[model samples]
Target: METSIRLEQAIKKLYIAFHNNHLNPECCKQCAVGNILDNKDSWKHLSDHHGSLELNYVGKVHESFGRKFNGYSPLELLKIEAIFLKACGYQLPFHHKNSKPKNPTHKDILFDGLTEVITFLCELDDVTNIMDYTKLFEFKNDKPLHDITEASA
Candidate 1:
């Protein structure tokens, strides 16, 4: 998929994830990029891993490039949020269920943090070892494994 299309889908998922997570819409306003920045410490763990220091630093440094936006627009930042949510298996059309996969769990939050950090690294132009980090962001295909054609009434 094209990067922009993927980004759009990711953004929609993020909005849904945030809502399903019970985050205040007023605080996030359908885009929680500012909320993430406001709670940077919570997200710091995303890059706390030993080898992730470089990747984390690269993101921050790149963030510095755009004085007004921290090197990314609000949409771009939201895209990162979407990437994080997706990494933790946040699919669309959220529904109430009696079993697992109902809402974002604590584990999902931590995984999201890690995903955000890794995605930042992936966006870097200088990074050459993308394969190593790509796996961290992998997600199962959302499309059904089997196709079912519609049946005429």
Candidate 2:
């Protein structure tokens, strides 16, 4: 179990977790994310899952076909999350959210930011609770942690 700080990887984990019943719409903050991942088109305020993404609705319709794969732009996604966490009141079980650094880098910081998110999710459900932070391995390539079979077998 390695800590997974990569945003794409973290989203991958959530996508897998949601599909596998490790997460529930009633508990997790990402049901909308899962909906987008699954290619469903729907409009609902962020309130149901705890209202983390209502970043000033100036007629910006947030919909994704799940074709784009990555649910939200790294910057957009993290900001929405901050809103979610703020709405959640930054209380017990979830660690206090950190203000993201302003310096820019091509490398994604959202990945690193997910550690706290996973922690927050864990506080909400069964799937998140068992997420071994150590199991999130990192590699600098486009390869799946290992060949598919090698990883599972």
Candidate 3:
């Protein structure tokens, strides 16, 4: 329900990118973190390699200074991109020789990537996964779980 401003903004951007055919696993400006950062590829400089968890010198300096782009640390942006790429079926450290989906832009492939990225974002914000619907099917004492809605209200 209650989400950080940055998380909410990031989710909205991702949602728009997904539906608008703007999400791309291979394009730095169209990837998950890029979309979250308003289609900017500057986040790529945070790491020496795409999908790498280690921060480069510039990234380390930003992290040390508490610099946040779009409310996410440089390291967080790298992690988000890594998660998206991995879930989309790409081998880490994205190289032309690395394994990747037959059609990286396919809706199914993008959806899978977005799902994982969203889950990671939720974890970062310490919030329930917005895409998770498992709670709607929950049951207790052989009765449907109806208390969540009531509690939310």
TM-scores of all models?
0.34, 0.28, 0.93
The runs of at least 3 residues in candidate 2 whose Cα sits more than 4 Å from the true structure, single-residue gaps closed, are: 1-80, 83-100, 103-108, 128-151
lDDT of 2 by residue, 1-153 (tens): 333334435556555654454433322334324433443323233223233444334213333322222434422443435533333334322333543234211123333333445554444333444435343454457644535466567
**Model 1 compared with the native: what TM-score?**
0.34
In model 1, residue pairs whose N, Cα or C atoms come closer than 3 Å (at least 3 residues apart or on different chains), thus clashing, are: 63-70
Q: What order do you get sorting by lDDT, best first?
A: 3, 1, 2
Predicted candidate 1 versus true structure: per-residue lDDT over 1-153, tens digit per residue = 234433344344444545566332123332234334542323332232211222255455544564223334433554555554444444421123312233445545534544553456346423443235444445568654333332222
Badly placed stretches (over 4 Å) of model 1 are 1-36, 40-67, 93-100, 128-153
Against the true structure, whose TM-score is highest?
3
Estimate every model's Cα lDDT from 0 to 1.
0.40, 0.38, 0.94
Evaluated against the true structure, the overall lDDT of model 3 is 0.94
**lDDT accuracy of residue 110 in candidate 2:** 31
- Global Cα lDDT for candidate 2: 0.38
TM-score-wise, the better of 1 and 2 is 1
